[model samples]
Target: MHFLSTYQRIISRLLLVSSLIVTGAMADEVIMPPAVANTASNNVPTVGPSRPKNIIIMIGDGMGPAYTTAYRYYKDNPDTEEIEQTVFDRLLVGMASTYPASVSGYVTDSAASATALSTGVKSYNGAIAVDTEKRPLTTLMEKAKALGLSTGVAVTSQVNHATPAAFLAHNESRSNYIDIAEAYLTSDADVILGGGQQYFTPTLLEQFSAKGYQHISEFSELASVTTPKVLGLFADVQLPWAINDKQAHKLSHMTQKALDLLSQNEQGFVLLVEGSLIDWAGHSNDIATAMGEMDEFASAIEVVEQFVRQSKDTLMVVTADHNTGGLSVGAHDKYEWHPEVLHKVKASPDVIATRAIAEDNWQPLTATLLGFTPNEAQYSQLQSARMQGNEPLSIALRKLIDIQSNTGWTSGGHTAMDVQVFAEGPGARLFSGHQDNIDIAIKMFSLLPQSVQTP
Candidate 1:
């Protein structure tokens, strides 16, 4: 009897592994409708097209550990009205390292990390795309522009925020909003989209106009400008979230529209699309807002996927700069699954006053507070401290507690945790195993022709 029981347990373990492998591979198959076929020209040099005609880099600015896991629950849950497609799904591979040059630490601010990702070098936090001496660093966009390629940047946050500004702005300080706005004029980035119109007032507006940039403030005006070069800024700062700002317009619409206009140049173009608020959601500890941001981020990914499918030469890279909130997951099983938990996570306004909260470790307090608490199976473990006590920040978040059913966090912060990177196209195969964040810039630049290697 003992022998038979041991044999059965071994079989169960193998079957579970097999199931996971199959599910993972199957989920990785993200089919882009045929519209993506011509994203890069098929007929190319025998040596291969040295440069992609179009490059779309999608960044989830504040998406750290907590955000990733929380969204996974939403996607895995069949009860939701909208299906979530995380950019990670497209990843043929992954990595967990996002360290800066100065040292190894748990939390590296977005400004420093983004600067490294954008310019291929690291600097202290709060520095834009500049080196330690406060000198400007030439970014990939600058290199592309030097080679006559067009460029554009789009974000859901203030255009000059740490993530988006890192691509084009080179300032001693990332906080120099006014100067960062002015730098856009010199970028030669033919296309510029997103908010922060407030930065481009009459004085700055005149500068762009003088440089011969066709600038517009409204979506309708965008169509009329009809210039080979276009610069569109819709809001004074970051555009409103799709949920909170539906009265405004859609992010995917802006992304698709930017691609439409930028693709006009046969010389090729590079565009950066960011879902900045996923990070904000982590900071606020607002689960619903975070899910909303993930859905929006997915729409932007669909746009890139569509583009990638059309163009064989185009390499679409989707990744987060770092993981925020140390996001993690509960062990998956029948014991923790609950549909009512989804609506339960709302963060406290006090979160802003402080960056870390130990009690919000992701277990669905909503389930506990609602009296649905864990089943007898889970309670046995909790009683032993395998799980912590249930603690909900507020009634809003409490409702979601039952759904997530997870708990464990050192603090509310970005982990030195390695972020995931997904790539698809001709040279995408080069991405595998672990690599430095700066390696992304190096690998991408290597594919460019010699003349553009240094710009």
Candidate 2:
């Protein structure tokens, strides 16, 4: 009897091992989407020359570690294996701390963090390319322009927004949109593409034209323009969220256009491209919107990756200003994440809020955005909040989605958490390991001609 039982146990162990192998194979069959898959095929090249001639800085605002992990899971819902590789996966060299000057508090805002990335100076929040004393500082783009190289800024938000503005304009306040626009007109930047038509009046457009800039409002016009200097304003304010944007130009298209224009300079160029809406989505704590924005940003990165492959002399550095919403994937009692639920979300919280106000209905808006009809009590609470005009529609929508999706957020504001930095091409090695955000600007400045280096 003992011999028979021992033999049976051995057979059971073998069967278990076979079953595990089959499950692993089944998991492997669940391939990643083409968008997030590794396209380079492990052909990432090493730095050929001493220093890169051109530098492209891409900022995905509020893209923290959690955001990347969530995006990977959302794109490829693996049951056993790790999430599929993204464009960033191949280039990730280090992480950076994003704290600003003491005057700005511990959690840095876009302006201060971008200032650190552009000028290598830590300034208070809302101060663009300025020191803590409000003194203007030279930026990487300025150095590029001074060296007779081209410069540009492209973004999914207003051209005068904090991130892009820090590279081109110096002001004590980021909210000075008109002043920022004026500064852009007088700057040496060759290409500027983004929203914020409201900030650029007929006078400013004439100024741009007088400066030999071809101002374009439509994507078709933007694509056809062969001018080295182009200004594209696609919307009145911030551009539409990716999930709701259908008519406007995509971020990837803007990035390609910027690259085409900047590459015209034989001496090389410095360009900043920002995925600004990712920050907005994080602030709203909307997972679906965040996923849409992240996907769009990744697509932009793919475009830049192709450029990096072809132009070996160009260096690309991608990082974030800070984290927002304190986003986490799992919830209490839930060991698994349901990124698939994000697909059912139809619109951003901004869209839902606008529609609710315009149509004077909350039930259908909630159902449409959250993919579930609210209970009678829940509907009444939303209706009451909307009627009172005290509770923000975004907060209400976020609360509802949180309850349904099991996603968690600590706050609606920024966090001091360190963000990832991915770099490739010449000088990419300098960005590896833990460092402060200002180190990026310092290293890029070191690579420029000595004559253009700030004292």
Candidate 3:
């Protein structure tokens, strides 16, 4: 009898592991582990903690620890002996695991991670607030709207992108851009600011106008938006990178505008601000652009931090969905990494490469944009890459930058690494220490006026 009981227990454990490994379609057959199963009753507080009247959640897409560390060095004062601390350093409270549902393996995509962060539910890769079985999960933004609180999303990417889509809409796949864009018509977000003008049709614009939304396409027009409901699409797609942007601190500027509009509601508000292009720069392995994006994100954080300090009744949480590109400081067994080399770059590699390709005397143009002239070997490398096409030339330029700066990258994909969590103001203590990505949302749910029941 003892032997039989032991054998059965072993079988149960294996079956549980197997179930998690299976696709989302089969995940329903297995019970969740105790931690996730008992989360609502055990961790989600209802009455004890001080609930903030307002909440601000910021996501620095694909920013890992290395990215923060790199940013600190990138912005360091060479003349000063000690490295300058960045905004991320002052507010960091803890770390969070960014793994997706068992079906998608350990590493997570933006869609799944965003769903986890926004809805406090684990889902398969590419899912937009839908569970493994394609069931729509209620998001925190939806909850905020239901409670008659103000809600808004500000991002560098299109407002219909995965991160924002998870919070505002439910879809089977993030690639369904049109569906996601259409869903925003009823999202009830008061301040919608980002790119993707190509997705919003004339009919949709008319509908938005009928709904009392003031629409504008230029960044300057944001200053004249006095109405609480506004739609600002600054680019046809994702906004230009910070390095190439005409306006300095574009994300910070947008965040300030959103805050100005959302704060008008006396019932409180929930704002989601995403530094969306950090992930894109990481994916391209463009160190210069990545640093520029991080700078913009940091500036935005500073804006939110000041608001939190002033409001006192507000809580602000900042974190990343996942680490992209497996970024490392030093490569090829080098003892030193030089972030200062990147300080000279004035534009993204793609732009530099494209212009270089067009110019007959490409060396002068490349040197002007890069802030430094290429050596004989790098010149040969760029010439060889230029023979192929713009993309290859851009890749070659990035490689040259990597060599000069001693930057390292594992892959042009997401990594199963932990991301940092930074918080401030009321209810910030709850996010301190280590937790899962879903736990971040769960804690935020606890701070709401009402409890969030487990689904």
Highest-TM-score candidate: 3
TM-score of each prediction: 0.71, 0.84, 0.89
Better of 2 and 3 by TM-score: 3
Where is the poorest 10-residue window by lDDT in model 3? 21-30
The models' CA-based lDDT, in order, is 0.62, 0.79, 0.86
| lDDT tens per residue, model 2, 1-455 | 11233234334433332222223332122122122223323342322225577899999999988998888778885565766788878889999988887666679999999998998777889999998788899899888898888999889899999999999999999999999998998786899988999999999899899989989887667779775789999889777788776444488998999898888877888989999989988887888888889988899998998999899888899999999889999876787677767777787865776677667555776687777787888787677667655337666776777766678888788999999999987667667778778767766775665444332
- Point out where model 3 deviates above 4 Å: 1-48, 451-455
Estimate the TM-score for candidate 1.
0.71
Of candidate 2, the 10-residue stretch with the lowest lDDT total is 27-36
Clashes of 2: 0
lDDT of 3 by residue, 256-329 (tens): 99998999988788999999999999999999999999999999999999999999889999999999999999
Angstrom error at residue 239, model 2? 0.8
Task: In angstroms, give how far residue 217 of model 3 lies from its true place.
Answer: 0.9
